[model samples]
Target: MTSLSPTTRTTLGRKRNRAASDRETLYAVLDEALICHLGVVHDGTPLVLPTGYGRDGDTLYLHGSTGAASLRTAAGELDVCVTVTLVDGIVYCRSLNNHSMNYRSAVIFGRARALTGRDEKMHGLRVLTDHLAPGSWEHSRGVNAKEFAAVSVLALDLSEASVKLRAEGPDDEPEDVAADAAWAGVLPIRTVFGEPEPSADLPSTWSVPEHVRTRVSEAAAQ
Candidate 1:
């Protein structure tokens, strides 16, 4: 496993042991996450917004309304901080202070550049769409010129980033461990794709596609 070279900004000062130094780990965490929080400074005040994103190789893409002020601001190659977090389980300890959660989180710090040109924009949007829904880009209708023009796409490099994860049982004080007065365990949490509910106007003959069915099964199995 190749480890990511730590920079002054990416180094962790607290709980350093939990920091993940591998780029593969960062990619895995990003791929598994469905949504990410984007942080940017608007009017000298920090603003964070939750949005869907996609990753291709070392670049992360984000899309939103073309007229959105936030996207407009970020499009000027503005500095931003993007983060994705996945909670795997809840850890219960004997003591409240010792309680924690098992999670994987990635933080990316970079400047976002706006994507232009129809081909580049289309490719960026396709990457975002495919990342969120796997095969939906091919299955769904193509985006028209008008629809494409109504949206904005931004790309950021994944070079300056960090990943940290915690996957373990509770760590309680020795006295608390011996006391054993409360339950201590881990309740696993995960994303489950339930049965797909078809659109009301769709014909009954249109059953779930094989790709979607397979995805649902895969999610359930995980």
Candidate 2:
């Protein structure tokens, strides 16, 4: 259980009790979240965009069209911040000021490098595919030369990162609890995969894939 050494940028100035100290916690938050916001500065202006990402050990991979200016800027050896968040529930407190939510979040800071080597690029793409679509890589065709040339991939290290989490129920004030001021509880939140819609062009005989069925079943069981 290696502790995540906090950097100057990652130090929690307030609510330090919510900060996570282990690298495992950071990895868990990243693995559970599907989308991340990537922040970088381009031409002296700050840009933050939500995008899909994949994790491989201590590295995070992001991909976009080669012509995207933001992607180009992020891969130019400049500092970038990436964040992932998962909302568990909404806390309804007795008082408005005490209202909050339960969530797990992570923030990573580092300069990303562009992946140019054929093997490395393919590896990164594999990681991305596995994370985003589970069994898609094995079931679908991989990238060809023209397709590969159209996408840009960047790899960022998880060396400097921070994780904060809150999972308990509402923290109503003592006075509110004693007086029974108002109702207080948690409204749990979740993401579930609905019924799969088959492509119109597909054969009517075709059925949903096992991998997809597994996903829906897992979500329902949760």
What candidate 1 gets wrong by more than 4 Å, as runs, is 66-75
lDDT of 1 by residue, 85-178 (tens): 9999999999999889999989898887778888877889999998888888989998898988877888889989888889999888999989
**Ten contiguous residues with the weakest lDDT in model 1:** 66-75
C-alpha TM-scores of all predictions: 0.92, 0.94
Task: Please give me the total number of clashing residue pairs in predicted model 1.
Answer: 0
Measured with C-alpha atoms, the lDDT of residue 9 in candidate 1 is 69
171-210 per-residue lDDT for model 2 (tens digits):
9879999989699999999988888889899999988999
